[model samples]
Target: MSDPSAAGPTIDPMDTSAGNRFAPYSPENHSAPLWIVSILGLIYTIGVLSIRLFIKRRVFGWDDSLIVAGTLTGLVQAIVFFKALKSGLGQVPEHVPNLSTTASLAFTAQILLLIALYLAKCSGILLLRRLFVRDQQNTGRLCDVVLGFTVVCGIATVVMSSAGCPSTGSFTTHCSSTNTRWSVVTALDIATEVILLLLPAYLVWQLQMKTSYKLRVIAAFCFRILVIIFSIFHLIARIKYADTQPSPFNIVTTLVWHQTLLAWGLISATIPNLKAFLQSLSASWGGADWGYTVKAYGNGTFEMKSMGTQSRSHAMASTTGTENATDMDQKYETQIQTRQVGERSSLGSGGSQDMIIRKETVWTVVRS
Candidate 1:
């Protein structure tokens, strides 16, 4: 899990490979900007969450619970980061009288950030699971696997941030996050983001919908890419600063990206519900469903139904018959007799015979 590039012994403080990021400048504080953005981001989340709860027949669910948890954790972590900022967190550690306090606060904030992300990411996964858990292809089983992997990786990040990895000492006391620990942690973070993204794409692409509709649904899920982008920035920041000595200057970018990742992660989890809520308004006003409507069924199953000009046709044939109440019978008889008087004149020994034939016909026509 250790990154060879960030090995402490090889790091050159005088060198600018981190590209002027650690340049000596006026000691600045990012507490206010971060606080403002963090508050606004959470408010956005809350606004969407309110709509979600108020929407018709919306029941409190596990995903919603995770959203709430992530939001709360993020709020608390923001406060911790602000406190760290107040104590020379953005200044050179040597210049600060209380380096230990700043380091501890920052470390705690890192753990909390990872925790909030874990919760938010799980919320999004569960929301997606509602759509795929019952797929005929059974990719929901893959969703399950991803969920387990996410949980494992998320916990691993928490462990790595709280206590150093490679079987080292505690985070604040002896173990330093700069020793390739954070590079590994951030790599895992990016991996989770990538995997979460792939699941939605895979599930949506396999759907029985028009290509346009599939794209629309997948586009709706694309909000997560913002999180991934921010995570990539976060990873780069971690790696760039990993070998840099702990100072407010070198840590500011990392701090900003950390906040960015947390806020966006929480917000992305709420986007699906919020997007549907907006689309519902559009639909009420006679607007398009943008190609699909997601229907959540009982037993936590759901599907995205394509919307368009659809027609259904049915045909039926009916026949009636009646039984005849009356019955008729007809009979024909024929008889033949030989006359001896005429035959005796021809031949008395041979006897002549006369034959008679009769024909009768009976007809009936009935229609019902």
Candidate 2:
């Protein structure tokens, strides 16, 4: 890597001297940055749609809120990075018209990226808590442990990022510390994602659902593995440029990988909540409702009717009662008894039994 400072004092853009010439911006230099911005925008749009579906179900929780917050921060970082590119961040130092402005934008963009990454990780942790922790009392313990660990990691990342480039006076002066900081942050990020992925695998395995259903659910949540893959790529890019002085290609590569990491992080966090939307779309296309309907009768009996194309019905007498004889049928008085039949199966050898009993009561009173 060439010493950036040894290249000489900053050159003014307006200087017409032959030695002070700067390369003109072209499509080659701008394409990567524009592509990164467009990708970020698309990911943000999808994340927003997923979150909207989640909210429409009236199941919005802390995890969803954290994801939204992280996304906003990521948007800010993207804008700042775009500005840095416009200000000559990915251009050769000699071609960079205003080095000071570019350095400032780059520093601000990194700080925002660190904060956004932390928030996204925390969002994933909160999501795991909501999915796996059923007991309210035990929720605090597991959530606190994960939250504290994430907070510590976040603080360490911010501190290191800030310490890496304490002053924006010169970009190359901080290369060594910046390299170490990014490597640490990347490792911690991969660790947190692994923890998030493992936390739910055990719970999913313990579910009483069919094996295929369990595998499907596990696969949906396992999308975080993509985020981990992106993080690895980002780490590799950082390492590749560890010894090189900041240049147009190096800066663009780092920015691209960084955006990719954040994009996948947001996507993974939002994917699970999209199941309801996907189911709705499938139902719309298939023109079938896949659920059971329960109807109660005046005789203290109820029937479970399958609503879809594969229709089946089950009727069980919940209670028996005799009405008191009266002058008029409408004037008769009766006391309806309610009883819950536990684990009743349909009247067939291979009928599937209801593993859980649903208790409901219906009463009619008449006076004349």
Candidate 3:
């Protein structure tokens, strides 16, 4: 793969003399990777934005902010890799215009990739923390421990990758050693993902919800399992190219996987915040109030409740103190149970003693 002659007319292997061997630069080779990154970035941005718009109270939380930072770093990494490809990164060494410059750009790109991955992992963990760490549940302790472990692993992988090779010369001379270091980093990446996958499963398993609801929530969180699968694919690709010298194709494949990892991670983190949005969409299409309402109490607390619409109508009709009203209330009482309970503090500065009742009805039909 290092033979420039094998690359055809674009690269001239015969002119191996120092500084005269680089082929004419072309921008086309980078188009695929750039497009992949762009599409993934767009999808991730939409997911995060949807979270803010749909979940109202969850706008730009710690996890969302971290993901935004990660996305920016990922964009930088993609740009650097694109430039490196134009410098002949995947082609034969002699095809590169400036070997030193390519090496430096590759090094920078590698570091940025690591930083983006770290931020992505942390973002997912923070999201899990928000989802599962509320109240006095001891489950929060597990999330804390997993978060600490993820931080340690991310830092360790970055430090090892940076320090494993002192210079570009050493990197070329010790391809096997570099491969070994990357293997460790890949292992750490998979480990962190596994921890994240399990955290949500554990939380959902302990919830006292219906089996169907548990399964639905678990399915949403389980989307990150795709990230784990992608990580394994990346590791396999890295091993396959380990002996071939870092070429443009190898770097492109890595970038593709990296972008995929970022997209899936952001999507998984945003799933929990999408319930209200999905419910609203369903209600709009079905043309019925979905028995969901947002209400504010006098004590500066807000609650969202889901009740049966049919039961609500019957209760309204039976408002008068009559025997039929009493019977209807009892018959429909089972349908008014709370589906999900969330609390938020009011943004106003009114005294706690002030009695205020505010209600906002969000329409949607309840599906049994």
Point to the candidate with the largest TM-score. Answer: 2
For model 3, what is the error of residue 271's alpha carbon versus the real structure, in angstroms, after optimal superposition? Answer: 3.2
**Model 1 lDDT, residue 270, Cα:** 73
Q: Write the per-residue lDDT of candidate 3 for residues 33-116, one digit (tens) a residue.
A: 546564667566565655544454523467767777877787787687667656666555545577667777777877887888
- Deviating ranges (above 4 Å) for candidate 2: 1-57, 136-140, 283-368
Ranking by TM-score: 2, 3, 1
Candidate 3 residue 346 Cα shift, in angstroms, is 9.6
- The TM-score between candidate 2 and the true structure equals 0.67
Instruction: Give TM per candidate.
Output: 0.64, 0.67, 0.66
Residue 334 displacement (Å), model 2: 18
- Could you tell which candidate, 1 or 3, scores higher by TM-score? 3
Q: Rank the candidates by lDDT, best first.
A: 2, 1, 3
Candidate 2 lDDT score at position 122: 87
lDDT of each: 0.60, 0.61, 0.60
**lDDT (Cα, tens digit) per residue for candidate 1, span 169-226:** 1222335555466667768877888887778778777655456655765676678888
